[model samples]
Target: MTTEQHIRHRADGSIDTAFYTSQGRTRRSEAAHSMARGVIGPLVILFSFGTLVALLV
Candidate 1:
């Protein structure tokens, strides 16, 4: 087998490289989600308050 294939498969015939890649991707996605929420959350609150004020006036 090639070196790439060897790294992907272990002696027990299970995939190992995928787990590491998947964990990395999950962590990246979680971080992005947290950042987006941090930015959008305040904007949403501000917009809602402005709308309420506009309606009251």
Candidate 2:
């Protein structure tokens, strides 16, 4: 990654949402992964809890 990729804000002081770096994926892919995690993480937890409760009951 280049030094220019470290910018976290726009020139107008708005938060930049496109910021992502390649650990093992490109910036775009990383952003998508983050969004998926945010949406799916809650559902996964809910499903796991439901499964455990069903087993116990």
lDDT of each: 0.89, 0.78
| lDDT top scorer | 1
What residue pairs are clashing in model 2?
A: none
Candidate 2 residues lying further than 4 Å off, grouped into runs, are: 1-25
Measured against the true structure, the TM-scores of the candidates, in listed sequence, are 0.72, 0.52
Question: Tens digit of lDDT per residue, candidate 2, span 1-57?
Answer: 646555577688976655533333576687999999999999999999999999999
Tell me how far the alpha carbon of residue 52 in candidate 2 is from the true structure, in angstroms, after superposition.
0.8
The numbered model that scores best in TM-score is 1
CA error at residue 13 for candidate 2, angstroms: 32
